[model samples]
Target: MYAIVEIAGHQFKVEKDQKVFVNRLATEEGKKVSFDNVLLIGDGDNVTLGAPAIDGAQVSAKVLKHLKGDKVIVFKKKRRKGYRVKNGHRQALSEIVIEGITASGAKKAAPKKETKKAEPKAEAKPAAKKAAPAKKATAKADDLKKIEGIGPKIASTLVEAGIATFADLAKAKPEAISEIIAGVRGNHVTDTWPKQAKLAAEGKWDELKKWQDELDGGKA
Candidate 1:
């Protein structure tokens, strides 16, 4: 039997005893791990497909090792600004071997609940706090790095350009966004940035992620 499962952020077709390398997992080496996001299962002539993911279906595996992948060079340049950045990156990876595939009755591991400590008795009532005007929290910039094709420099540039939040980015036109980042590097495609930011601003993460998967950098 073989199963298509999502490990880390990527999916793979795995079978018993098959070794696979995936994005770095938090589980330690030699530890057993189970993936409940089973997308499909096939056993010879019979096939079971999931509507997104099958309930109670799971793929078990053991972490064999952790390692780094080949280094990739990243170079960025800003037009006529003498701004240049260069770096190298290696993807952290984990090696694991498929142990078993369960068709049903697989229980998901529940997260450990945090214990709450007893609050110390306050001499003054909480109503006393209401007397003081509430201070508004300072708005913090959203991580634009979460958007595909937007690196640290571009994110900083966008933030400095007054497009600090996802909502701000969503309201920007593609042409305006392009002009805003014209000082920075390559031929960037900004047509999808507003769309992606809109989804993020609306808290539609899954839909945004699905759309991101289909995108090439920021291109549709």
Candidate 2:
């Protein structure tokens, strides 16, 4: 029998006694961990698939060791900007051996019900009641990189200058927007930026997408 399970956001086809390396888990070495996010199981000709994940199904495994993967170099450069950055990264990983697979009847741990004594209600006076405090308005920041020709550097630059949302971008002038992103080291055009941002802020994705298709890197 073999089962497909999700461990640390990655899926794997595993069987009994199989060794697999996955994202680093918080479990200590030699400790057993059970994954309940089973997606599929197959035995001979019969197969069982989950609606996202099957309830009462689990895959048990024991952590063998932890290790780091090979270093990967990430390089970024901008033309004529004299800007270049390089970094190396190694993903932490854990090795585990599958112990067994339980086909059914695995129960999730239930939280203990707390028993609290009921308190007597206080009598309210007929005089008056205190007013509730008002909550401050919070603004949601949009992904400025979604705009055509707006890369990470330009997006961050705009954000640093308080143009963090699509609404703010929609209200900004082309010349002012250009000045805001001047330090980003790119000859970016912003004539259609406000229009695009207006469409995006209004949630007109289809219209924005069609307009972007006709645009040449945010130029008119």
Q: Can you tell me which runs of candidate 2 are displaced by over 4 Å?
A: 105-220
List CA RMSD, all candidates: 20.1, 19.5
Per-residue lDDT over 99-139 for candidate 1, one digit per residue giving the tens place of the 0 to 100 score? 99998943221121124223212312332442232221124
Candidate 2 pairs with clashing backbones: none
Output the worst ten-in-a-row residue range by lDDT, candidate 1. Answer: 107-116
**RMSD of model 1, in Å?**
20.1
Clashing pairs in 1: none
TM-score of 1: 0.47
lDDT of 1 at 203: 91
Evaluate residue 56 in candidate 1 and report its C-alpha lDDT on the 0 to 100 scale. 69
Candidate 1: deviation at residue 213, Å? 39
